[model samples]
Target: MRRKIYTKEQILRAAYEVVATEGFAGFTARNIAKRMGISTQPIYLEFKNMEDLKNELLDLIFSKLKNEIFPVPHTGDKVIDLGLNYINFAKQHHNLYLALYVDEEGGGKKMHDFSFNYFSTLIENDPQYEGLSREQIQTLHTGTWVVVTGLASLASSGSINPTQEQIISLIQRTINNIIAVNETVN
Candidate 1:
């Protein structure tokens, strides 16, 4: 019988599956190998170590979010769509969400920076944001981030299972209030 050889992509995908379903606590080479029905040799051969594989996995997941997940237009409102996508992702992939956002050492800072920049860019192009200064836009981004991240964290933890309408209303109202306050302040 010939040995089964796995490419780096295949190994990385298997690792994703492990992390997605089991979270970082179970994110181990042994678990990944078991999920792939292969020995750990293939994983080690493709990557230098578990940390190396983890960094690559983080990049792959971020690429998926930036390219595949968050880019999809929904509800015709960029901010609404972004918030919904984030909440849905947390709801659907609770373990992965917790792993990526909840764990302090899980590169949450990188994810935060990426998300803030992405949100800021969206605001820059939005007509509603046209008159807002960069500082105000940053404030809006921070406010929106608080609302969205709070909802996502709750969703990931199963603390609040709100309907789509409730989630949308909450996000919209919070954003409106923030804008009102920002306008009043300046």
Candidate 2:
């Protein structure tokens, strides 16, 4: 019997769904093939190895983040909404988010850089920060990214047990502190 040709995109999509739903451990050629109703040979044909497929999945996750989570407007408070959205994404897509940021090497670095770029862009474009120096704006952006990422990671991992409201409050306090310090120095 002739084997049906499978596109790489099809394989990646199936693999992503499997990883998202079943965690990284569930990402195997056999499992993906089972899900796709095909044999593992197609996957091997498309990807050099499991690691290559996993890296592509990670890249897809980052693409999703860029499209979905990172475009949130600053709304006069850079930290609050951004942090809320970040935590919400993690909680809502626990397995996928964990796989994207936790289970893979270099995942954290990608997330950190993506987050920093998002925050920096927001700060640079906001009219409220018109008079702030570039260094100050960069500092604020980095501080906000750290606080939000830390809180989101903790919340997602169950390391911090707090209601969403409480988490938001803590984030607000951190942002307020940063603003206060910036004010005093300026």
Candidate 3:
């Protein structure tokens, strides 16, 4: 009798689910194998090692962040809308958000850099941001990202419980302040 072979996609899908639910601590060969109803051998066969699989997962997260989350339809305000979308994504995918951002120590830097680049591009393309210099645009992105990410973290942890409307209000206020300050500086 031949043992069924699992493809890389199958292993990654199971790994993603495990990481989403149980976070990095549970992201092991055994955990993924258990979720897939198979042995660890399939994972080993499909990848060089666990680190490779983890890199692939990180890439997947980055891809989602860029293609799906960042480019979300404009809602009259590109920066604020994108910021809101980020927080909303966190609110919707708490486990996934935590696992990707909070579970691992070194993982966030890559995501942060990716977000910075994406936000810079978004703002540069907006006519409303035309008056702002490159430095101001970068600063604005930093401020908005920090606020929304903090809000998402707190909301996900249930530390400072805020309604979605309240979160949006806070984000709006923050974005307004950022722009106002930048305008004054310029």
Tell me how far candidate 3 lies from the true structure as C-alpha RMSD in angstroms. 2.2
RMSD of each candidate relative to the true structure: 2.1, 3.3, 2.2
Put down candidate 1 lDDT per residue, 1-186, tens digits, no spaces: 997789999989888887887788888999999998988999999999998999899888988997888867777777888899998898888888888888765657777887878888887888866787888878877887788889999877888888888888888887788789988998
Better of 1 and 3 by lDDT: 1
lDDT tens digits, residues 6-113, model 3? 888899899889878888888899999999988899899988999899889888878888888866764577887787778778888898888776666326777777
lDDT of 2 at 57: 75
User: Which residue runs does candidate 2 get wrong by more than 4 Å?
Assistant: 72-78, 104-106, 130-138, 157-165, 183-186
Candidate 2 lDDT tens digits, 152-175: 788778888678678678777776
Structure candidate 3, residue pairs in collision: none
* Candidate 3 lDDT: 0.81
Candidate 2: C-alpha lDDT: 0.76
- Tell me the spans in candidate 1 whose CA falls farther than 4 Å from its real position: 1-3
Among the numbered candidates, top lDDT falls to 1
List lDDT for all candidates, in order: 0.84, 0.76, 0.81
For candidate 1, report its TM-score.
Answer: 0.86
